[model samples]
Target: MKRSKLKWYGAKSELIELTKALIENGNLKGKQEDIFNEIQEVFNIELNNIDQAITKFNTRNQENETKFLDTLKNTLSKYIKSKLEKNR
Candidate 1:
């Protein structure tokens, strides 16, 4: 697949978190490392030391740990609400 010009500016830990969620929810199928490798390939970014990154992410305060995912949830909720309102 062609690599996108878009780059992931968020922390690698955020990607790791998303990857884990996808796998756990059965949205994605594969070992975490393999899925992460595909993500890196698609984004054309290298994420080294994933184990260390995950460790650091887990050690963060509760509110901070899933910051990116929380933001994603909020953003998607707003978008859906806006669409629903537009159709009402």
Candidate 2:
């Protein structure tokens, strides 16, 4: 499948915020203890410049989305991909 190249500014920031909310609200279900940390690791890159940050976030989000979809079960992956489609 061909991946779309549209970019969303502050998506990493949005991801971090949503992940934080899920953790704080205990909204994530079973085996989610380290999931936020995993997302954090993806956000930890040193984007010293604004352009760098934007580029890095876009690149990482694309990579992470690919991996996330690959790991999801058949029934759930489409749901996730659907949510992502709105942002693009």
Candidate 3:
């Protein structure tokens, strides 16, 4: 089955290019399980950053800003998860 392209701004594009570069530069030379585990760690780090950002924005319009950021984080994380699952 064909996978659908994610629409989380440049995140998915950057991720794909980085994965390509890793493979091309032989940085990703490892067993499939090892690679999958590494990718999961990357996603977890990114998600934590998003969580931090959401907490960092505490200005007047905090609720609005947080909602927007939460949306972005959800979409981005979802995209990353989909890409990993698709590859598997």
List candidate 1 segments past 4 Å from native: 1-6
> What is the Å distance of residue 47 in model 3 from its true position?
12
lDDT by residue for model 3 (1-88), tens: 3433433344533443444446558889886345644554655423224323323444427565444446657999999999999999
As a TM-score, model 1 comes out at 0.76
State the lDDT at 40 in candidate 3.
Answer: 44
Ranking by lDDT: 1, 3, 2
Prediction 3 TM-score vs. true: 0.30
Candidate 2 residue lDDT tens string, 14-55: 554455446558877555446654544455532223334334
The alpha-carbon lDDT assigned to residue 45 of candidate 3 equals: 29
TM-score of 2: 0.27
For model 2, the superposed segments whose C-alpha errors exceed 4 Å read 1-10, 29-33, 37-88
Clashing pairs in 3: none
Superior candidate under TM-score, 2 versus 3: 3
Q: Model 3 segments beyond 4 Å from truth?
A: 1-10, 45-88
What's the C-alpha lDDT at position 53 in model 3? Answer: 39
Error of 1 at 31 (Å): 2.4
Q: Report the lDDT tens digits of candidate 1 across residue range 1-88.
A: 5658878888777787787778779999978889888888877788888788777767889888877789999999999999999999
Model 1 pairs whose backbones collide: none
